[model samples]
Target chain A: MNTFWIILTGALVAASCGFLGCFLILRRMAMLGDAISHSILPGIVIAFLLSGSRDILPMLIGAAVVGLLTVFIVQLLSQNGVKADAAIGVTFTALFSVGVVLVSLYTAQVDLDLDCVLYGEIAYVPWDTWQWGGIDMGPRAAWGIGGVFLLSLLLVGLFFKQFKLCSFDPALAAAIGIPVVFFHYLLMTLVSFTTVAAFESVGAILVVAMLVVPSATAYLLTEKLHVMLFISMGVGVLCSVFGYLLASWMDSSIAGSMTAVSGLLFLLAFLFSPRHGMVIRMLARRRMRLGTN
Target chain B: MNLLLALQDPNTQWVLMGCILLGTSSGILGCFAFLRGRSLVGDALAHAALPGVCMIFLLTGSKSIGLFLIGAGVAGLLASYSITAISRYSRIKEDTSLAIVLSVFFGIGIVLLTFIQHSASGNQSGLDKFLFGQAASLVKSDVVTIMIVASVLIGLTAILFKEFTLLSFDPGFGRGLGYPMGLLDGLLMLMLLMSVVIGLQAVGVVLVAAMLIAPAVTARYWTDKLSRMVVLSGVFGALSGVLGTLISTQQENLPTGPTIVLSATCFFVLSILFSPRRGVLARLFRFFKLRRKVLIEDVQQALYECLEEQAGSSRPGGVYLGIGSAELALKSGKSLSQVKSALAEMVRQKIVAERAKADGSSTWTFTPDGLKNSYLLVLNQRLWDLYHMNQNEYHHVHIDQSQEELAPQLTEEMLEKMLAQLEAYDLTPKLTEGTQAISRLYAREQGGLSL
Candidate 1:
């Protein structure tokens, strides 16, 4: 039962990030996802200090606000004449460091575990269960993460055309009266929501892996965005289950095990994908050299 | 304070010197990475070093920093090599390839790290510090190894600085010159790997790559020259190390890695917002000042055109027949309010005078100084326009900034050749390196090229 709950929590976090990851991958903003994950630290820290508890609402609101600020700062710097990557490197590190310093300053009294923010406490997920009038609702992380996953699904579904059009051609979308920047901020908000929600179970860096790795693996196997989205979600769910099993078998971190599984799956796809695998490319080159189609 | 004692302690001195050395070396190497659009490679390489550190500890059953660095270096190399190979062989774009390498390698590292933590190895007890880092654990021997690596990386950067500038600014040109592009790039990556791996003990694998990029990126806002940027980055890197080490010591439980990484970011934020030429604040000021000058000139031009439009038909100073804001706005192709505001400021400056009118609209005419200035602005604009029109080529990047400085005595024929030369040179900043010319053509990142 515990294992099932833990895997369910991981799966919900994975599902939210994986669905959003497809657009991030399409928009060439995977690094930006990494940046957002890093910058959310300061937000979560501030929210924890203010709320004086690990309440999910303050944490989500804080992470979302900071996530938007991260995008704003990056865009501000790039527009005012900094390179896009440098701007990202500058903002995320600074904010993340502030969070680290704050966590250290209040190390004694704060129930907030900073190390867990880095390494995650997914092993303890089953223990933090939600209940209603004595009725058990499994892990709270599962509910929080599941709620975010559903919101993302609804949001992505409703604005599917806008997100797709903007990701491919933002200028064209803007000309067609779509609010490109608003939609961009919306996507970033969702990214922040997903990242912070998962931060409890998977850690900040692991969020990057979940957002980027599965979608990227799916990218190797398919060219269509819709296909890639579903494939990545499938890959992500599988990673959570397998990763949970691997961690339990090895008596290690479930998040770490899950990330390792994600990597392993990507490697398999890289080396053996039927259409665009590395081995397939080598074979094609050989065949071409032999004067065959 | 404990910080004062920590500063006085000999062990603290060794750690401080070691961190400064690490910063200077990585700061120098990171300039190339930042310039060549590979800033995130440092982060990837940093994460990639983890599994190597864990594997080495498990294999050797000892906690040797050097052995771990070697393991980390090999792992980093494999990550970078695979990134390149993946992009080359697969249909994956470079960024997705980078994302793949980064996340996958880090995932494997996390797995290995968990395994070691769960294992019964005494040597691996403190290994988790490699993730967030605890610089206070540095020993005298660790400092010595760091110094050796630092000096070697610094010496290599100094010697190969020119080749690196070429490779970063223009790989095509480097290849055109018969340079071994792959070898040069590999050597650079290797240098970056050394710096990153060596610094792992202090800044940790999580934020070490950022320490590489932050100082270099900060330095970039201060200078366009690669050499100057490298030197500035090294200096900034060392300063951040000192600051971070000091801050951590002053506080009770502040870890050194994030502090050090954060210190570099402080320098970066300062550079991006406050640096003279490249900073956001400075550029915003320059842009507004230029636009205001252009705006005032537009009002003057509008008045002059209105005068000329009347001069040929109605006679002398008929242009000064008390022009209204609407007439000026029409002539300037600006809104009435925009023209009115310009007229207001000009009146305050005594460049124009306002007179009461019949229809309740105020009118303004140029003062003596205003007439002369307006004439000069008009003449300069037309000359620039004529040159651009005749040449059929202009960098819109320089159109506003280049007026009133064209050596007006030169003939049209001379101006044609000189304008092309000047336009290209203007696109590039005035730097001492020969590649500065080519970089101007290629590195237009500063002036919103390819924006």
Candidate 2:
């Protein structure tokens, strides 16, 4: 029962991140999510080092700050004539390295380590639960991730029209007096927050899987943004459930299990998705040829 | 200084040599990628190698770099193939496809790494670092492997350079020429994938992307000519590799991959600022020099005209021996004394002549040589204007033809006949005058010619 609840919580978290990630993926800012995931290491490290605790608020604030910084630095470098990809490479790697160095330097005195920051401890997560009024609330990760999901949902709901306009045609949006730069930053900031929040349960590395796979799978399945978001959220939840079960059965890491399941799902989608999948489309052609004959 | 002594060591020398070979070859292969405008595909492929590396380790229970690299190469190729397939078949953009492959593959890798760490296998501790890269662990055998792969990539690039260039610049033309565009494109992608895989051991996934793009971008600032750009990019890549390796060797824990990227970026920055002809500095310098020369020539021409105006009375001595000459020189930013000196020099040069002064000031007039020189300059300018007008007309015709919808039954022969007729009509003076007027109107604006 406990494990079921835990897995449910994981799926909910994954679904929320995936829902938000669809926009990022469609906008071709998937790598930006990856960059935010890696760059938040320093923020989390500093937060832990300063607070001497693994409280959700301080960690989220710290990671969000660093994540925002990553976006800003990448934008600044690109604005100053650095190519976008190169700027991303420079910003994320340097920040990640700095984070690693800080962790290594502080490990002697501080309780924090790079492993804890990178891979995270989803298994131990259930132990860190908070109580609400009269009920036994779930783990801190579930609540933290849930809060992020709500915030993202609110933002997305409020600016759904604006986001769609900007994502499809920023030039047109700018011409029509839409605040393109502000929206661009807002999207990036949301991505950063989602990444950090998801990092609590799934780890920094698997957060990329959550951000990319569901959206990519959705892309293969649909053309519309609304459809993509729904499909991505559905795929993420399924992967979370299947991955958790597989990890539990095989005594494997939940994060790895989730990623592998997602990868397998992508492969299936690539091979069987209607209109786009390779095998089905190829077979369809063969059938057409036979019919013509 | 002690680091200099370390360079004399055989181990250090070997590492340097290895980096040189790797860098040069990767740079050469990168030309195809740069020309294709898919320079960052190498980076995506590099990241894609991670999942493959992790999976191989999990399956084989071995940490052998050779096996690991082969796995990575396969994954890179798969990533490239997926990117191509996705972009071709779907409405998803190229960058999006790349990002999709990159994140999903790396995610799989991360998952695999976490699983491996949790597994009974005790050797999975440092597996995740392979995602970023650690070039210091390279051995002589690894260097040899890299060299072999690099050489193969370079040779393939060289062999297919002409075909690749054709396809890159104009795929339609390449197709018209009956070249196997698909085969050549695949070959180029294969070579690029191989280069990215090989670079993993030296720079790692995080920085290998820079290697593919930075050197090529740097070289672009140096030349418009393809051959020169390739060679220059190769040299820059090699220099960066050697320097990065050497720097990493000297400093403890300084990653080889990041160092190489930083060094490559330095080259890119320097080329942007200082490369000859096309560089920012050179362009700025040329602009200023041209402006100054134009100013100087305008002043001299104005002064010469004043002299000619005064000499119209046939009493050249009376015209030159007056205050008019001094006023012309003052208007042209020259002092009265300087104007006199200039007139004397011009007379010696046979561009102008000085006559006896009627009121203590000498008169001047333009010589036949000066008239001839001005006439030639005007003719040259006219010829240039005509050529550009004709070029613009040709471009407009080409664009119009491309945009026109024609029936499938309208064969190439028909198109050629139509073109011939158009050319014949274009030879008429009226048509020429029309084109000239359009070009003149276009030239009135201060913008580049739009394609």
| Per-candidate RMSD, Å | 10.0, 11.0
Taking the tens digit of each residue's C-alpha lDDT, what string does model 2 give over A1-293? 56766686678667887887787877788778778887888898888888888787788789879988999988875775556775676567657756765665577655654455555556766777878896778776788888888888899899999999998888998999999999888877777777777776777756777887788888889888889899998998888889888878766667767777887887788889987888888899999999999
CAPRI tier for the interface of model 2: acceptable
lDDT (0-100) at residue B331 of candidate 2?
Answer: 66
lDDT, candidate 2, residue B67?
Answer: 88
DockQ agreement of candidate 1 with the native complex: 0.58
Q: For residues A110-197, what per-residue lDDT tens digits would candidate 1 score against the true structure?
A: 6667668776989888888888899997888888889899999999999999999998999999999999999999999999999999
TM per model? 0.86, 0.70
List ranges where model 2 is wrong by over 4 Å: A1-9, A31-121, A127-140, A200-205, A222-224, A271-293, B58-60, B122-129, B270-451
B73, model 2: CA deviation in Å? 2.5
Report DockQ per prediction, comma-separated: 0.58, 0.25
Residue A204 Cα positional deviation in candidate 1, in Å, after optimal superposition = 0.9
Top candidate (TM-score): 1
Instruction: List where candidate 1 sits over 4 angstroms from the true fold.
Output: A284-293, B1-4, B299-373, B379-451
In terms of docking quality, how is candidate 1 classified? medium
